[model samples]
Target: MQNREQLWLELPPMSPEAPRRLLVFLHGAGSSPEAFAPVALAWQLKFPGAQAAILQGPEAHPGGAAHDWFDTRAVAADRAERAALAAARLAQRVAVLQQSTGVDAERTVLVGFSQGATVALEMVRNRPGLAAIVVAYAGRLARPIRSGERLDATVHLLHGEFDSLVPVVHAHQALRALHASGTEATLDIVADSGHVIDQQLIILGTTRVMQTVFRGRRRAAGDGRTLH
Candidate 1:
């Protein structure tokens, strides 16, 4: 698994200037960082001030070629354990990226789908002060994590109305948990959608994160006026 972790990170192209914001994407089960290339490209174009980097998960797929954030074997029985393991691995990767790119921890956002979403939430919950925002799609939080802890960032939960894989009910439960924990979180449901990603939903999700980052910067500037 250590060697697998070393091989997991293959960063996409990026520029300097501190990257007004950084989006780190964690791919779902059986998928690689490549799966998020399209969305990263779209984000780069749509949010010029932000840069996107997709990180492959640390576990290799059984009898296959790619990597996964967590071992899916016992996910059904002990998802919280798997999520915790993945979150620890993701924290290492994020630390590496932050050290190399000189990006502020508060300017970084974590986005994921399916199992990837579970990993992202775990990372944020465990490392509360690092990430600026979290965007989770078609996923929920693992159990045993307290729902009364405060977070330094915001969270966005997106789930499909017809997602059979990870039911939308779980997503709502995660949202409620986050709120109970005193974290700022918003949940959005896509009508008639399934487990797959929707173009409009991606746009909406990414836009919300960008808007939050932009608004924060404006507030920090102390101009007494919102950027809008």
Candidate 2:
């Protein structure tokens, strides 16, 4: 992991006792750390006593009023390269924080939206055991994943079926890659949503994590499904 520094907002654990879990949040492209704070808080509230952190993208978005994890102007493959760089730095930060909080990688939960979500998935693409679970929304796989590629994180991909910016097809493609890599993953498509975040999606994400990450249960099957 790269040792480059990244900005982070820490929300101390609700309890002073030793926290066993760490939650990390990343915002979408052209979105700020503040804009994603509420989503982080909601997840934290659902998982009591877990420490949480919100990471801000390093550069400002060219469009203004926000930030981006990588340069969007770059071509498809180049964009993935940029996202990989950002993911390396963010992974380093998370590792350092985990040491301080006494939370191991298996107890870490990484969540992100859009661009941030891509980087979140990238974190575990080649590095197994970085995070126990990853919840990515409205994001595509930045890198090509081959069959049997090492990945220990159980990923939950959530997307809007009608998403125009990043078509739901991207999520389906990612799921296929994940499956080929023999990774444990799931995809949920919301029927009545677009590119934007929907409350129902958020609820589904948290619920999914709570069921598998915390409760150690498995869903019936490993196929993608549309949610009404």
Give the candidate number with the greatest lDDT. Answer: 2
The alpha-carbon lDDT assigned to residue 206 of candidate 1 equals 84
**Candidate 1: which stretches are off by over 4 Å?**
1-4, 8-19, 144-147, 223-228
lDDT of each candidate versus the true structure: 0.77, 0.83
Clashes of 2: 0
Candidate 1, 1-228: lDDT as tens digits: 135344433344444433466678887888886667776676666555565678887778888877777787864777678888779877877877777766677878888888888888888888866688988888788774464577677988988899999999998887777788778889989999999778877987888887777778778779765332
lDDT of 2: 0.83
Predicted structure 2, TM vs. truth: 0.87
Instruction: Give lDDT for model 1.
Output: 0.77
Inter-residue clash pairs, candidate 2: none
